[model samples]
Each structure stands twice: as C-alpha cells, then as structure tokens.
Target: MQKISTCLWFENQAEEAAKFYVSVFGDSRILDVSRFGEGGPGQAGQVITVEFEIEGRKFMALNGGAPANFTEAVSFVVDCSDQAEVDRYWSALTDGGAESMCGWLKDRYGVSWQIVPSVLGSLIGGPDPEGAQRAMQAMLGMQKLDIAALQTAYDG
Candidate 1:
C-alpha cells in the first residue's frame, strides 16, 4: 500500500474518470470501488469512490456531488522521452480538451496536465545562459513540445 495518494473530487464522474485514466496509461488498473449504501447521500449502489493506479502512482476519484472544478494551480506532469511519446499523450489527453500556453492542457474532465519532454529541463537550464533563454523562448511558442526545435534553440 502506498502512502499519501492523490484524491480527485468530481461531481459524479468517479467511475468514468477512473476508467478513462486507466485506459490512457500503461501499467495501470482499477484498484477498488466503494459504493453508496441504502438511504445514503447518493443513490444506492452508486459509486462513491474509484481507486486506481497509473504508472505506480495511486489516485482516488471521488464522487463528491458538488460542482467540482479543477484549476491549473495543481497539475500532473507527463514526462516524455521524445516527440513520439509527447505526441501520443498530447493527442489522447487533448482529444476533447483545450490547449493552453506552453505544454499545459485541460482534459475533457477539466483536469490540467503538462505533457513535457524529458530534455526540457536540461535545455532550459543548461550552463549556457543564451542557449537556455533561446530554448525557453522556443518552448513558450509551442503548445506541444518539439525536442528538435528546442535542441536547435539550445544549440544556437
């Protein structure tokens, strides 16, 4: 059992969101589900929470039954090794979502996610200040990160 897992508050999309997330990531599955009992706050047999794990991180989707709006203040970051990986995640996550500045995006469920490349850190924090700034500039203009473009900026 992992300690300190994340819990997502939802109006009523606990099961749906958990299943969607499980399908999106590899090495992930539904862990457990707790349902409402008779004469409860929710309908009997309705899912109260759906626990799941994605890439080793555990998450609980809760049917809090309120207007659960997610903000960009907290977001999950998906680090990709290359353009293909980045594109894959971007496509899946942004299918019904909106794109934001840089690599930030709001998924269909209103969850913010940052799909970034693994090399972004090095490119934007390299020893060469000019190169780093160039990389940062390149990243600022990109919705989906392009490793080649960032590398070119850093190399310049």
Candidate 2:
C-alpha cells in the first residue's frame, strides 16, 4: 500500500469515473469500492468511494456531494514514450473534455491531465538553447503533442 494516494471528489460518479480511468490506462485496475450503508449520508448501496490503480499509482474517488471542482492548478501527468502513446491518451481523455495548450486536457469528469511525451523535457531543455527554444515554440502551438514535430523542431 502506498503511503499517500490522490483522492478525487465527485458529485456522484466516483465508481463510474474509476471504471473509466481503469479502462484508459494500462496495468490499471479497481482495487476496492466502498458503498453507503443504511442511515448513511447517501442512499444505501450507492458508492461512497472507489480505490483504483493506474500504472501502479493509487487513487481514490469519493462521491462527495457538491464536489470541489477540479482546476488546472492540479493535474496528473502521463509521460508518453512516443507519439502513439500521446495520441492514445489524448483521445481517451479528451473524448468529452476540453483541450488546453501543450498537451494539457480535462477529462470528461473535469479532472485535469497532462499527456506529455517523455522527450519533451530534453527537447525543451536541451543543451542547444536555440533548438530548445524552437521546440518550445512548436509545443506552444500544439494541443496534443506530436513527437515528430517536436523532434523536427529540435533538430532544426
């Protein structure tokens, strides 16, 4: 068990969100689910919390009433090895969500995610300052990151 895990507050879709997240990431699964009991705050049998794992990271989703809305201030970063991985995560996460600049997105449930290519760091922070700046410029214009484009910019 991890010492600390992320707990997402949801209005009433903790279980549904957990299931959706499990489907999106590889090596992910639902670990446990707690439901409301009789005389509880919510209706009996309704899900109260869901514990899930994504790529070995633990998370909990709670069906708290009037959940605090998620903002870009806090986002989960998904490091991608290549463009395909970035594309896949972008599609899955942005299905019903909004897109922001530079590989940032909000999932259908309003959770913020950063589906970034692993090379982004070296490209934008490489020894070649000019090349890195160019790569940064290219990245600024893109929504879902394109590894090829970033590489080209870095090479140029």
What lDDT does the true structure give each of the candidates?
A: 0.94, 0.94
- What global local distance difference test value does model 1 have? 0.94
Best of the candidates, lDDT: 2
Q: List model 2 lDDT by residue over 121-153, tens digit each.
A: 999999999999999999999998999999999
Tens digits of per-residue lDDT for model 1, 10-73? 9998999999899988999999999989988889999999999999999999999987799999
In candidate 2, list every pair of residues with a backbone clash.
Answer: none
- The regions of model 1 sitting more than 4 angstroms off are none
Query: lDDT value for candidate 2?
Result: 0.94
